[model samples]
Target chain A: MEADELLVLVAAGDQKAFEDLYGLVSGPVFGLVRRVVRDPAQSEEVAQEVLLELWRSAARYDPGRGTALAWVLTLAHRRAVDRVRSARAAGERELRMARRANGPAFDQVAEEVEAGLEREWVRRCLDRLTALQRQSVTLAYYDGYTYREVAERLSLPLGTVKTRMRDGLTRLRDCLGGVA
Target chain B: MTGFFRRGDLHSLAAPYALDALEPPEHKRFEKHLKRCDSCPAEVRALREDAVRLAWSTAAPAPAALRDRVLTAVRTTPQEPAPVRPEPLPRARPERSPSRGRRSPFAPFLIPLASTTAAAALVVAALFGVQASRAQDELAQERAQAREIAHVLAAPDARSTAGRDAEGQGIAVVASASRRAAVVTGSGLGTPAGERVHQLWLMRPEGKPRSLGLLAGDTPLVATGLGTNAISLAVTIEPAGGSPQPTTAPVVQLALKSVGFGE
Candidate 1:
């Protein structure tokens, strides 16, 4: 069933529909959270919270705004970022310092791996972006770094990072042919 | 940050805003702008769809257990009643002054002018008030979470370990014996395939391996209820959600060491 249709049922208090929605979304939600929050246990916690929020806020779902999956993923991403930011603020300075010292070289391993058609297309689109643009977008989106953080990490001006992100996403949108 | 946004600046923010890349204050400000700006909303919607595609590219199967947990929660948790959609504001129609027959031509323009002024004021007031209060609540919640983490880190007897995965991916853990909590941080672990995720495990000398949780990204993770008996920790590449048992060899393993209050 369409997520929107399922959400309509869920909004009306349909447990079965909510279950269906969960099946359709939990992976993406969890995966997205994992990408931002990194820790297995806490990722699970954040994912659970995002899903529960979905159940509670299903009534607020507006078809005019976006699809059910997008809304759910957005919520998951926000929650995951929140967890990361809060942890950073909570005296994890040593850990953050360690991470910065051992920064991951953003590689194409993720794009090279075997995947479905949609994933391949996404990778292909991402590949088309300039290295700077790709890095900026990936750092901000998948890594959950704010634009300002991305700027500091890349040692570029904040305006440059913002422009790169915006331009990169615009190109990606065009490359993906607006299918998503 | 609380000033009027130029048209170009507002339009440019649609992508970052859609991707949740903006700071909280910027995000909230853009959202308020989004409500009144027709063009930007559609742009944001499209950008969000693109992000959804990106999210789909990394789709890993969630843990089987999570399904049950979420469903159980859904069944037990009361569903919020659907919100009553607010009625659309009545259109501003010029009220005819009956006493002034054959009204001056300027009167026609005057009524709409008055109505438009009132509607604009109402919208600005309502939107600003709602957004400001919501931002404050969010800020408060964030501060609370930060305080909780601070307390955990400040606990005495906090032991920590740092190591690297086989692929040279960095992983670190800080555990507080008093709080029975630990936070794991990972880096250089690139995005896993759509079907897999890196899972962290807490291994004891004797009992079955305990799943600490799964990493979503290269961020810090908090694990609670850490057992004193856990002798070591290991991470492995497993199917998304995670596995009932380790499905692959450990990517990295580190022995837990006692500190300060010697074990």
Candidate 2:
């Protein structure tokens, strides 16, 4: 069954369907959170939280909103971003950045991403963006930087960073052919 | 993040918001914008789909035994009840439906509690600069006010607008039509000269203006029971204990657009 179908069953409290849904989604959830959060142990904790949230909020899923997969991933991404932005993690993030000489936050994580067809397609789409646009999106999404932080890290003006983020996502949306 | 984004260009924040790239304050502010911007929800949904694709591009497998940890925990975890959807309105208007059990009017706003807590902490920290030596009672009162400010900013239907007072002090208003509440914060507002106070009023299209309350310097002022007909927020100087109505012309009048109905 598709994830949408399984999610509906999960909403109805079918344990088996939830197991199936987890099997289908856990990889992407863990990967996405890990990409943003960086630390493996912390990533696992956040991934578990996202999965539990999915279980707890299954009934809140609205098919009219977007796909079940998109909803799940959005929850995961938001959770990861929140983790990175929290006060506790802020100090650790600073240390990590200093150690890495403040390079684009994606280098290590990007290399380790599984070479799946989806990964290749996304990379191709991302490659089409201008350097500044790609940097703006990745630094924010993958590295979990706020757009303002992205601007400061890139030494670009706030307005320019905001524009690049919007334009980058717009181009990516068109290039990805409207995934929803 | 509050005063920097022009009201006309808030829709531009949609993409960053969808990608989870905004700071909490900006995130809350943008969310309030989203509720009244008719086309924004669809735009955000589509952009989020794109973001989800970016998530999928990095699908590394989870640890082998972690699956059991998660599945086992799920067995004991009770699920949350789905939110009750409000009946569809014929036109855009403030939406109010309980997401869970009926909440008391004074209960802390609960839906976005985590982010609101963080934002409120920031507000409290900002207050600490000038309020550190204040009495404990005043500290408690200010904390509550900070929470109220955070609540209004964090409301799902909150919308923000900014204007300048006569002295060029920046005034920001974040209003939630669903909650019938608004929070007014100003930068560089001057203390009124002897025996007078700065006052806030909610200006309605037809009725007499309703007093919100006295504004003390730059402390955020929260006003509840905002009428749907409220057209703008006005601030004026009133004699000491505040007045039944404004005796002076508004030094700052911010037109409140995009509160509930689409612009």
Candidate 3:
């Protein structure tokens, strides 16, 4: 079913519509959110919230934005960032995050999101970033970090981190289009 | 990185800074520039689109059970699409309809919480009157209240953000598209002291901060209006109710814009 029709059904409480929407958009939503969140178990939980949020907010979906996929992806991004920001601020959550950063969930997420031209392109562009730049931008843009936090985390000058992020994103933007 | 600036560059590249794609003082500096720069505003839009695109880049696989979970959640929960309006009962039913339970002489007292809803309505009326009296405003000095009301009564922000409140404690709250948006109660906020209430401000990049509303003591602050088009929610310690504007500095500033909603 088309995203619009499925959304209408979702508004009407059609579980089938939700399932269909999930099948269609979940991968991108999950993948994008996972990159920022970086914890597989928590990623799954947040992704679930994002999907459920879509179901609940189906009535709010307007076709003008893009596709149902794009809409869900936006929500996923915001939620992923919120999770990271809160966890970091809470202090304890960051400790937990660091401990789990290298857990099996990352592998699982990689397995789930590893394909397609766009993904391949993003992966390639992401690879071109220096280790610190990649980590900072991934955390700052993808994870919603304040520059101060990203700088502190990487133990780099706030200025250096900022330049890395700007340059890194500019490269990604140019790679993706004439535009980030 | 500095080499990118060699080719007639003068920090014009700071437009993507909204995505935190730029660094500190420059980030602060460009923010000042964003207000007067129309071209930069358009550039900000492009950068935001890019950010949104990056968000959609690799699709992550949702849990297998997500299908079941979401479907089951939607299925089991009743959708009150419109408030259920029961069709007029098949006019003139027998007094003792067997399907609905045997009618007895004591049926008068057994209102079943529905029959006397009309009489019980007095309770609702009284409740509304009290709420109206409490929530009603007496301050005639407030300006253009209608437009402001629209901004305030908007559905309590449905979106949520993770950040720290003024006290630097963890908080999750949603800001409206503007400071006047109706705020649905979230899990944060407590009463501040006399000369110290929760002051809401819409912090524009370079412009003087516009005051949204206040979270006073006792009354639930959830429904208060937030600054719309607000980049961040800054709560300050001002006099009871709130300052005509912020008198002291912001105690907490949560940048909801970074979460990409404002984008």
Candidate 4:
């Protein structure tokens, strides 16, 4: 069944439909959260919360806006940002990054990143950026650095950094070529 | 330039929100704009799908134990019945329930349900319940037997299709060494078939497989799990009510994924 139909059933308390919905969307939900949370344990936690929310608020989906996948990705993105933006951001984020970046347990994630840098759509979009734009975008996003931090790290003027980040994202949106 | 907010500025600001790089104040401004902005939601979605792809660069082959843990958590947690949220259409009609049709004459008389028809109904319900309970016991026995057969045939290193079958199929597919066992079709699986339904049993050792359930649709779905090493599985062409044993040749044989074998 289509996601909208399945969601309708889920609202009606159909457990099987819920399970089926999970199978369909789990990959995207887990994949997106995994990148930002940067820790398998925390990523799993965030993914679970996102899914539970999806189940609870399934009635809120508006298909007129986008595909079911897009609606779900939006939810996943919001929740992931929340987890990373928690008050304990610095310590917890650093710890999580350290585990994934240095620990043997996260070898899989690191290796995937190294290999995936070539194939990811965002990465491809990044390629369309001017050199400084790419760096500005990366520092601000994947590394979770702010514009000021990105400027300091890149040794560029703050305005220049912000401009590059902005320009880079515009180019990315155009390159990916979606509803916008 | 509506209300002094230029299109160019809104367009530029939206990217930061999409990338999740916006600060709280900026994020709120965009959220407010998003309600009026047709393009921003789409941009965010495109950005998120891209975000997901970027996220995959950070794949962690899910831990082996993760599945078990997650499945357990999902299974055990009493999920609040998800409220059916239909796709938003402006003022869509309220959906009617299947039972919204004519009420049985018994319904009004039993408004408070004078405990009698409800009692007869309970008895009728109980009659089926008793049958279902008996079937469950039989299913348990069948599963145990299948486990035994699986044990006998399974190599010491075998990952006997025990919990996996039950877990995945939402039913117990346990087995034993006797080439006999029972299956408890999980409630997650479908309900019992109507009048005439399904019949199941062992169909290995070259003889006819034994009959397990009728229409096999009853709760726990009249399942009797079996191992290939123990016995072959085949559905029988029985009446909708099902027979005590195989009264006919096997009708449908289940090709288990190499049951009674090593993982």
Candidate 3 residue-wise lDDT, A1-180, digit = tens = 545568778888777777777766777677777777777788888887887777766766544332344455656766787687778677745534342221112233455553333344455557666666567666666656666666766778866776776666666665443211
Number of the top candidate by DockQ?
2
- Going through the candidates in order, their DockQ values are 0.18, 0.20, 0.14, 0.09
> How close to the true structure is residue B38 of candidate 1, measured as C-alpha lDDT?
56
Task: Find the candidate with the highest lDDT and give its number.
Answer: 2
Q: What's the iRMSD of model 4?
A: 14.9
Off by over 4 Å in 2: A87-90, A93-95, A98-107, A110-112, B85-263
Model 4 regions lying over 4 Å from their true place = A1-5, A87-125, A146-152, A155-162, A173-180, B1-11, B36-53, B56-61, B64-263
Pairs that collide, model 2:
B32-B158
Total backbone collisions for each predicted model: 10, 1, 22, 36
Q: Which ten residues in a row have the lowest lDDT in candidate 4 chain B?
A: B99-108
**Best of the candidates, TM-score:** 2
After TM-score superposition, the amount by which residue B37's alpha carbon in candidate 2 deviates from its true location, in angstroms, is 1.0
lDDT of 4 at B147: 49
For residue B202, model 2's alpha carbon misses the true position, in angstroms, by: 58
Candidate 2 accuracy as TM-score: 0.57
Residue-by-residue lDDT tens digits, candidate 1, B1-263 = 33566766766777777777878777777766666765565566556666666776665567888888988898888877755652111100122221111113322212321233322233234334433555666867645544554555566444444555346675565556567676665656676778899988775422356788886564445677765444456677898789987767565555443211101
Return whichever of 2 and 4 wins on TM-score. Answer: 2
